[model samples]
Target: MSAFLADRDSARFELRFQSLFNAGHVVSFPCNAAGQVDLDALSERERDRYLYARAVVGGVFSLPQKQRRLD
Candidate 1:
């Protein structure tokens, strides 16, 4: 239940991320310890996509929880 929805959400987020990544809006997706995007490393446009992806992923996306939280 939750897992499936989570997977779906992740897929959607990945799609959105890829769209911007391919569009050259994001150079790299350097995440913090908690796996969220490291805004310090991202430009304003990249940051927007990152935040959008975060929302699409239901705010549960990260690089494996090994990175620190972005905010």
Candidate 2:
């Protein structure tokens, strides 16, 4: 029971995440100092990685943790 319950805590976070805000602001599609992407650096493999992951917007999160401890 201890092993199963303890391990399940980490299982709750199987999803991986990446924040593009800083990167998106720094890079661009046509490769500019402040407003474009570096086509040369965009790998097909990297694009596929994004396609597989979930997309989030406005710094939102699902299921806020219970604030009050259960009795």
Candidate 3:
């Protein structure tokens, strides 16, 4: 029983970690090598979206993994 519970818990933890890693990849794809958006190259609307993404990604990665959340 304990072994089964441990296995299930490990699976859940790995799933969560994979999701976060995938999200990091996605958020990373949009930015340049320096991890910054090129505001001048973007349209006004795109600039807004880029800025928002930057802030959200920055905050998420800045916090401890346990405390990371979009909210």
Candidate 4:
């Protein structure tokens, strides 16, 4: 793996997509500090969700927010 991927693997972060219409609904994926997700690290279902989230930004979901994992 490249250095970038290696650094990301050790970080605990998430890219969160909050629903534009819903108050508490959120979709999140594992990501690096810069909000970059490793598609190869996700399962098939998760990969699909990630792509869907990207497609719906600004329509169904607001812009993604990068946050460090609390746990």
Estimate TM-scores for all models. 0.36, 0.23, 0.33, 0.86
How well is each residue in 1-71 modelled by candidate 1, as lDDT tens digits?
23333332222222223333233432225543234443554578878866665565423333222322233
Ranking of models by lDDT? 4, 1, 3, 2
What digit string (tens of lDDT, one per residue) describes model 4 on residues 1-71? 64656994436999999999996999999888778998888889999999999999999999999998878
Where model 1 places Cα greater than 4 Å from the true spot, the runs are 1-28, 33-36, 58-71
| Best model number under lDDT | 4
Worst 10 residues of 3 by lDDT: 10-19
- Candidate 1 CA-lDDT value: 0.41
Cα lDDT of model 2 by residue, 1-71, tens digit: 23332442322322223344453331111122222223334478655443333233335322122222122
Residue pair clashes in candidate 1 = 32-67, 32-68, 33-67, 33-68, 34-67, 34-68, 35-63
Candidate 1 TM-score to native: 0.36
lDDT measured at residue 52 in model 1 versus the true structure, 0 to 100: 66
Scored by lDDT, model 2 comes in at 0.31
List the candidate 4 regions with Cα displacement exceeding 4 Å: 1-5, 8-10
What ranking emerges by TM-score with the best candidate at the front? 4, 1, 3, 2
The 10-residue segment of model 2 with minimum total lDDT is: 26-35
For candidate 3, write residues 1-71 as lDDT tens digits: 23333333222221011123445543222223223333555578866754555456544433212212222
The 10-residue segment with the lowest total lDDT in model 4: 1-10
Per-model C-alpha RMSD: 12.9, 16.6, 16.0, 2.0
